[model samples]
Target: MRLRKPKKEWRHRKQRRVRITAMIRKELDWIVHDKISMFILFFLPIFLIISVGNVEFNIDSRAQDTVVYVIDLDSSEYSLDYIETIRGENFTFTVYDNHENPDLVTMENAEALIPTTELGAYLIIPSNFSETLLENQTAKIDLYIDGINTIEMLVIKYQFISANLLYQVEYQVFNSEVLYIPEYRPEIDRSILENAVPNMIPTILYAVSNMVACQAIVADDPLKRMLLSPTRKGEVIQAKTFAYIFFGALLSLVCMCVLTFGFGIYFISPLDTFLIFWMTTIFGVTFGLFFSSLASSRLQGAQLFLFSFIFQQMLVNNLRIEPIVNYMPIEVIRQNITDIVYRGIPFLSLGNQIALIAGMNLVALGAAWLSLSLKKEVA
Candidate 1:
């Protein structure tokens, strides 16, 4: 009786161990098979970080090259010295001397030139600029900014204030009685939200391509059946690629129209802006395909895409990773587009960007094609 009881107890213990192992294996299988579970566990964190916490990552490297114009209404020696001090290594200034180009120095002219010039902002020195500092100890300056170039406007404003403060410090050190005070008057009233939409276009397109095109082909029942059919795999891949590009282009056009017509976000070169955005759409499509090819499942592909997109944005605009900036495809495209639309730079300047994006697309397409297996006819 004692030997039989020991044998039953061992059997019970063995059954319990088997059940526990099976439960763990079942959970692993579920995590692999369930797309929603995979996204929640892996991809949601990236999305939340990019979308919600992006306020901390709004830095732009391009702001360093921002240019502004200075209209010296008070063409005194003091004003010219002040203007010279402003033309430091940090920013470039286009000086319009009131004495030389008196016709272009009016307040009305400045307002009209705002729309026609590539200058982000312009400063007007009052006629009492030199006299005020030598007598009243206060100099007033007018700052007129293009409502479109928000980033450059802020940078120029900060640099202008810093330059004036430095000048004050130098004078105070030379003679304790001399006081230099500057008052700035802003001409345009605008908000940061006005330019946010145009800036976010690339990220929006990337997310769209990942969800609509890349995941659609693998997750849809009909597409999966086609993948298992006698269709030429290359042709199928081309069709999907074209569809995604078309959809992305359409979305970009719609967003641009809304920005141009509805809200009046300035696009100096409309054709250049449109073409560059279309090229970025191609980049987004290729990036989605690359992620899909590299990942094992649809959810995993989206997770990879989101992760890469966020990292690329940080590398290009938010962070100062110069060595890796040249290697990131979307970063190149975004920088070129920003120059074209915001800085009024010509499209021909984007020759390197065009070549780099083309190379990246070819590599991504080749990888995607190689990853997919075609169904062979059975004997």
Candidate 2:
């Protein structure tokens, strides 16, 4: 009886192993049959690596025309030399003599010029600049940069610093005198972490939610079987979407807590910030679902989501078009988040941004529903 029982156990174990092996084989076959998915899954990383590796990072190669307004209070030969040193092929310096136009020395005048002339920065050379440099002391220069675009501000700053370094080197060689030009950005008060974290939160949340939800419907093999029953297609999609949204809300909360406690970042209005985060997650999920419904396989869905995300990021950030940048999904979320978190602007004031996000969500959700309704088998 013991020997017969051992044989029965062995047979059961063998059958279970066979069933698992068959399932694995079936999945392999499915993957092999889907050539497009296989290609994307295998070659996409290599393609991305090669493409990114070929990008140019040299700032000099991509230098754009920058206009700087110089407020020269010194009116000395040394000050003129300093200005000439900083000016390059790409940099156009508009020198404003503080003596001729006493009003130009005021911060109000500088601020006014930025809007009207689209000025990049203001270089204020102190009256005692030449005297201090001649006495072998470090002279300070006030650099009031247009802080609206961080990238442009940085480029202008680095270019100035680089040119200043060359001037110092040349002066030391000729006169054996020490010179210094310390940059001061009065416009920007916040630290790099404070300025960057708020902008990054929405983007990170959107990316994670989109990636996870992209495979929600199209990759779900059991969804087809479920649809065979009395379960409505809308119910399945709704349940899946709601499940992801709940998970996304929890994720958003965790991210907020980490930003607040772990990173010591404070939100002006926690409730409004949380609401925005939740809304961003919903949009991400819906956007992913729109792509997932359009795609035939999990890999295809993921690829579609990736392409869309990359395209929008490039369009919004690099495209100099005002209308497109204002209306892009990522840009809208980022701008509103920046306003609420950093500027302390109330959520109610951002009705336009909220409405645009809501409208986009509706369009995406409708498209996903339509796609699913039109096609019987999603997978």
For every candidate structure, what is the RMSD over all alpha carbons to the true structure, in angstroms? 19.1, 15.6
Estimate the TM-score of every prediction: 0.49, 0.54
| Tens-digit lDDT string for candidate 2 (217-307) | 7887866875674455555556556666665676677767766665467787888888888888888888988888888998898899889
lDDT assessment of candidate 2: 0.69
When summed lDDT is taken over every stretch of 10 residues in candidate 1, the lowest stretch is 48-57
The residue ranges of model 1 lying beyond 4 angstroms of the native Cα positions read 1-191, 194-198, 317-322, 374-379
lDDT of each: 0.61, 0.69
Clash number for every model? Answer: 0, 0
lDDT of 1 by residue, 260-292 (tens): 665557788887887777777787777676566
Number of the top lDDT candidate: 2
Best by TM-score: 2
**After superposing candidate 2, which stretches have Cα over 4 Å from the reference?**
1-189, 320-322
